[model samples]
Target: MAEMLYQRDVYGKALVELGKKNKDIVVFDADLSGSTRTSFFAKEFPERFFNFGVAEQNMMAAATGLASCGKTVFVSTFAIFAAGRAWDQVRNSVAYSGYNVKIVATHAGISVGPDGASHQALEDIALMQAIPKMNIIVPCDGPQTREAVIACIDIKGAFYIRLGRPKVPTVENKGKFEFGKAQVITKGDDVTIIACGIMVNEALAAAENLAKNGIKVRVINVHTIRPLDNDTILKAACETRGIVICEEHTVIGGLASSVQEVVAENNPVKVLCLGIKNRFGQSGSPSELLKEYNLTSFDIEEAVKKVIS
Candidate 1:
């Protein structure tokens, strides 16, 4: 695997590249330009960047207004504020109006170490998934995050792209990313592992370990949470006979819930959802938190075993 890179930094650089190509692109940040990495674009296009002094709701409303005036607006902030604080504006002004506003929130999930439960956004995915006409993308690595940003810009609608704060290893699958398509990284007949965001890497690691134990596993990256690739998931379920979903967020309304909904409706199979089970995040290092919450590769391997058994 390549050296780890911060997904937020990749997003920031991607925005600068997109800004140069599309002059109509505008950026807004809620006093977290540096942390969110929007400062890279702010430096390049000062005229098109707006810093809304910690007012996430106002910033989202303004982004919707800018989109109304033919501008492709991209808003950045912490996931908690962007999805929790400004949820009303995002649903009403952005999704309801079908505005071309991209909400690229950083520091998502329990990875925002040292911030405690309040700052970490364990329910952002659940909150955003409930909104109609809102697209969601949770990229796993730096390269995928960059591609996700470009894809969101090219697509016309309201988008919520969840990004992480910690640097993660680059994904080995160097394939083109299509919105609403799940990439199958590995193929197997015993079980299937579906994951999004940082959990994709964990799933891959689990598959490798499972291979040593003579248990074949298929690993899929469900980068796009909403508008889920039901066809791919159904194929995996039919072929593998069982499924295990791993995610950094809560199991309540995240990738696990989405996958279960599809599996229950079409192909009923043994499904194991590996994620936080009705709990809140706590202060710790990213690695420590992941282990504490049973989000590591070992946890995924165990989940796969449980489903297959």
Candidate 2:
């Protein structure tokens, strides 16, 4: 595995670099800058950093106001607070108006660990996906997260960039990021595994394990959830024997649902979604929670086998 780096730190550092180049860039955090690593931007651009002190809704609204006034606003908070608690503001104040506000939410999924179910945002993607004109990006690793942050600056309208708390393995550093494109990490014909966020690393490990057993699998990193790579997904479905989706989020409206929608409409194929099945998270270590929720590489391998069977 490559050297582990926290996604939040990468995003924070990237924001600092962006700020140095663009005077219009401003950052807002809901009293969790330290945890979300937005403090890096705050430290360098103190005048542009606005700490909202736990008021996520107000922070989102304020972000909209700043964006309206020609500021490239980046808002940071826990995923739960950003997507759940501030949904109204995000929808009405940002997405509805097509504002250039980037919502970089950290601590998403069960990886939030000891913070428990309340903090873990298993349904954040679903919530954000439901809103019109809401662009969603779930970076797979540190490098991808940094690239995504930079990409968001150029993308117009409201954007939601989901990030994790733990130091996940850096999976993709060589590939260039496109807003609606999926990267084919490995090519195969027997099965295709579509994954995003930290689960992309797990999917890669699962593919390696399956290869040992003579099961060829294709691994695709679907970092962009909304405006999904429909062409790539359809091509994988048509070429591969079956498809599997692995995510650290709920199966309802995440990458699994997005891929299934594409396959069903274009070319029907068997799909096994490996993720939290209509359940909430709990307090535990990151590893312990992942094991308990069956989100490890072994689980992804099993799902692939099931889909191919």
Candidate 3:
């Protein structure tokens, strides 16, 4: 873990970078241009930017139309509305058609803080996971967010990127970003910690703490969830005695479920998870919410120990 940065802040700038490269790149926002940072693209290319004034469904439908005409459409809005409110269009029009639309949703998970449960999107991943032809990317920090932004442009199909509002510790991952590949941050034999988004940093911290106790913990950053890097995941499950899956979303249908399904069918290792346990988020500071939901490094450290035991 290193400097703190917001993935959405990096995403806003990355859109401008992509716009300058491709003339057919269009951006759509649900009146959250400033918050979601599609305003960066809005500023650079106002002619290509469209604001739907709070209608996420309309924005998604219009984006689908643009994509059908061979335009690479990038849509932005809060995570809740981007995945929940406009899901019909996202599923029926965008995903069902298999267009080149990228839904870069910000303010995801319970870390939106004082926004309360109404704004928090604990089920965004699950909702998108239910849809077909939708690639999901949960970048750990700003650099990876930029990497994902550039990589998704060539990927033919719809993509849902989940980004949070608050600044999170940067988890350093070696090598260039590859789509649908997992980065093993550390090598361990006792246990493996598979995580995404801000949880990557927590996994790293937990690995460091466990090291002092003479435990070898391998940490994996699975940025792309849709086409999950099953080879790396299965390798980790085979090399380690146990595995711990971590994410900021719900445990039911999110990262944990995905890893468990693969492991159960393949190697079948003892697994533990750190995430929301079937409940809504409440208004609180980001740090408080993380601890309240048992998503801190300390919680991960404990889980690793318990898994090993």
- RMSD (CA, Å), each prediction: 0.8, 0.9, 0.9
lDDT of 1 at 134: 87
lDDT of 1: 0.93
Which sections of candidate 3 miss by over 4 Å? none
Summarize candidate 3's per-residue lDDT along 36-120 as a digit string, tens digits: 9999999999999999998999999899999999999999999999999999999999999998999999999989999899999
Note the Cα lDDT for every prediction shown.
0.93, 0.92, 0.93
- lDDT for model 3, please: 0.93
Model 3 misses residue 10 by how many Å?
0.8
Tens digits of per-residue lDDT, candidate 2, 1-309, equal 487999999998999999999999999998999999899999999999999997999999989998999999999999999999999999999999988999999999999999899989999999999999899999999989988999888878999999999998888543888888999999799999999999888889999999999999999999999889998999999899999888899999888888898899889989888889989999999999999999999998888888877
Worst 10 residues of 2 by lDDT: 168-177
Model 1 lDDT per residue over 28-53, tens place: 99999999999999999999999999
Clashes per model (N, Cα, C within 3 A): 0, 0, 0
Per-residue lDDT for 109 in model 2? 96
After TM-score superposition, what is the CA distance of residue 180 in candidate 3 from its true location, in Å? 0.6
Higher-lDDT candidate of 2 and 3: 3
Clashing pairs in 1: none
Name the 10 consecutive residues with the lowest summed lDDT in model 3: 168-177
**Residue pairs in clash, model 2:** none
